[model samples]
Target: MKALMTLALVSTMAAGLAGCVVAPNSGSIYTSRQAQNEQTVRIATVESVREVRIDKGNSGTGALTGAALGGLAGSTVGGGNGSVAAGILGAVAGGLAGDNVEANMKRHAGVEITVRLDSGELRAITQDADELFRPGERVRLLSDGRKTRVTH
Candidate 1:
């Protein structure tokens, strides 16, 4: 009766440990505080834009430990052939538990933005650099210190 109780407990614990994995969140926005040259006719371009990143939470460590403990318990249950079979079964069960745990903790989401600038000549002025600039859009600028603020 005692051995049966122990086995039940071990199996329960192992089953509980199989899930873990945090999903990643979406991407985010980047900005620059640098000022453009005064009086420059800056040209802006929509380079790239994307979403925000999601947060990935940590999965519990209980799963791996539980698997190991369960395996040990299984091995101790029977002698010879029974013991070997129990250990193998325990490992398989434990691995599954760990995989599930990882999956649960998995995070999913990421975004990327890329901008490019144009090559030209104009006046030096801090005009509307990122005019129609959407959130998450990465703007790039190429300047000759003479004319435009090229935003890609």
Candidate 2:
């Protein structure tokens, strides 16, 4: 019983830690002026605000953690040969279940921002919507070579 409880505790902690993410956000950086780089900065008008969801794709941490926990729990179930078989079966089953749970937990809340550029081009970018934005508000589109973000 104690082993089972310990396994559960460890699995829970691992899953929680794996779900955390540190993502970029829009913020006001007080600067003398917009610094030019290889990046592009464009002025755009918010055309619409639509709620979006981001899937932080799983890397299988949950499965590995669950397998370890389940094997421990299953080992406590029987003796000798029976214990080994149960442990392997338990590990496989637990790993599958944990992966499913983790995928569900990793779904993130976001917003899809549709903007019309000054040159009359329409562009959309989805990001973590921690900050509120509205239609017709002026925002800046900052794009490096890799990713793009919208800021107020």
Candidate 3:
């Protein structure tokens, strides 16, 4: 039915919006800006590794998308005046739901790595948990002054 199709479309849009929340922040993935750029590489020993969560903050994309879909779906609910009210209500509810969804989606598993550099200085770097690290393990810390990452 038309309603089912609308639901499917809304679901698809929400999923696409959620997909936009994640980016390549892993140690192996490099951005276009990071490519061809020189980074300072240093040897370090892992002092401690702790699991953390990374939140990349929302960009309002999800809420906007959800509101549009919800308003469209709600307008089909009843007669003229009732439909307008339903659409408004749907939009508000959808926006809040969408924002919550986006916040959850944007959170990524990360690790806070405490390392002791060869210079005897201690630094803690937080990055995506895609790579594994263990205490006392030797790792490479690559930095470009702005960003840093740990790799084996």
What would the per-residue lDDT of candidate 2 be over residues 66-114, giving only the tens digit for each residue? Answer: 6766777687788999998998988898888777877877786789999
Q: Could you give the candidate ranking by lDDT, starting with the highest?
A: 3, 2, 1
Candidate 2, lDDT over the whole model: 0.76
Question: In TM-score terms, which candidate is top?
Answer: 3
lDDT of 3 by residue, 11-114 (tens): 76876566575566688899787899999999999999999999988888778767767777787899889988998988888878877877888888999999
Q: Which lDDT values do the candidates have, in the order given?
A: 0.48, 0.76, 0.85
**Model 3, global lDDT:** 0.85
lDDT leader:
3
Model 2 clash count equals: 0
lDDT of candidate model 1 versus the reference: 0.48
- Winner of 2 and 3 under TM-score: 3
lDDT of 1 by residue, 8-83 (tens): 7666566544434322121121223233434433344454455434335444454555566567667877889999
Give, for candidate 2, the lowest lDDT window spanning 10 residues: 25-34
**For candidate 3, which ten residues in a row score worst on lDDT?**
15-24
